[model samples]
Target: MLGVLSAMLCCGAVSAQQHEVEMIPFGNMDQWIDRQIKESGIIGGATKNVYAIGPTATVTETKAYKNMGGSPWATSNVMARVAGITKTNTSVFPEKRGDGFCARMDTRMESVKVFGIVDITVLAAGSMFLGEVHEPIKGTKNPQKMLNSGIPFTKKPIAIQFDYKVKMSDREKRIRATGFSRITDVEGKDFPEVNLFLQKRWEDEKGNIYAKRVGTMVVRYYTTTDWHNNATYSIMYGDITGDPAYKAHMMRLQVEERYAVNSKGESVPIKEVAWGTEDDVPTHLLLQFTSSHGGAYIGSPGNSLWIDNVKLVY
Candidate 1:
């Protein structure tokens, strides 16, 4: 029953539109979160289930064009054609400081003509400087955009993107960092929490740098969106450690666990959501959760997140 997608669903569960929606058995993250925080003396309320978390992005495939000559920094060394150090492709490609940085990739595996593309200059602080180019880029590196800045850890998982934000407001004296934690429960019993903390970080230098941060955004969870298909890029990932007071009660009882999904779009039990699902996704993956689903997210309105470090146990 570990990786099985078959769950006894709720016959009457409906969607937000009130149309009859399918409610699969929520993987037991609810009780898991409750049990984890039970001793904290906070009223652990049940929030809406999480859907997509991440491996924020994926590397499919690209073409191998000509390697021109500009950057002496990129492509200086060589090794396994599949993976190598960052600068290998920087010299020839269009670079924005560093547009797209990549390593340890297999273009053949991705089934593309090229390798990978990235916008590595995201980490740079100022407008007129070269940060770190992932591949050959054109023009000055433009700041990248993101669809979602996912959460850090959960019963599910997602790769935190550049747009993710952490905010502190007076409406409630809480600080919410997206994708910071996850919840899990089984048959109403809470599971042990596999927590993730924003343990480390480095500030970018004023000149061309490796990373950048916005005012309200948590620097740890996001990376600038400077990427292209078939190019390579390298960046860092980290977590955020803080608090956004949940409704009524908040405690550590919130633990996280996983349920497996099948080839079909079958639902997982325990009120969790799928943050990420795609053709590139492996056959087996965990049911992830996060605070990033802005409006209907559980607990506080703006206190939601997109979970990170997501993995399912077979």
Candidate 2:
């Protein structure tokens, strides 16, 4: 799931002059939708709360979630029904920040034990992005298939700005736990990251989604820092492969294709064809903030990323 939208860039030292800022709807992180769900009796029958970034409201039903109040944001929190058993997972929250609220994403471990004998544990990293997460997740297989990772965004913005802070896990190595498999170690330290990509996309007759990378901007937090306000990261347009600042491991075309529900209402792969030219105008935009750099079911527990006041600079 992490590879679905993987890309990175260094912080740009751009001057803040003659810049216009536009706030994304609900991007301020001050409003939220709260959901109350009750787990199946087989899983201990407990009520849980799952949250989404949307207009203020409370949902008590267990139905699948759709973006509400015209909000274009979704989180990793979800309601899942597997093998006739319903459960919930929540790693994103709204925390008080000054006079408003900010998003708090945490990397942690979750466990499920049935009858005090059958045990399952998995690592989940908190994330927020500009798309949708199809809910009532059926299974753990192909998690990337469960998400539509971007929204139609035709305009090109110079950079993205936001207030943020992070607490790194500070571990030398990361770990992976899929619940069904034994937890294993992964090479490299885990860092919280932010990514933005613009693409000119089209759909084929077979319902396949394809795109060329039009713009890219990504930043990884290597160390803990205090809240930084109005931090801006410029987007690198067009083919950045030859750029001296490019890091293949972090900014290359997605090795694994991402998924999007097509016009036919079928979930299909979004194949990244190539990088677009420098002057290309994008058809869509993909953006995300996560508490861990690694993909699904992988990360170091206790890592946290806080974000607020997200805006785009023109």
Best of the candidates, TM-score: 2
Query: For candidate 2, lDDT tens digit of each residue in 255-282?
Result: 4467888999988888898999988889
Off by over 4 Å in 1: 1-165, 173-259, 263-265, 270-289, 292-297, 304-314
Q: What is the lDDT of residue 149 in candidate 2?
A: 88
Segments of candidate 2 deviating more than 4 angstroms: 1-10
Question: Number of clashing pairs, model 2?
Answer: 1
For lDDT, the strongest prediction is 2
What's the true lDDT of residue 3 in model 2?
A: 39
Give the Cα lDDT of each candidate. 0.18, 0.89
Task: Quote the lDDT for 171 in model 1.
Answer: 28
RMSD of each: 24.7, 5.1
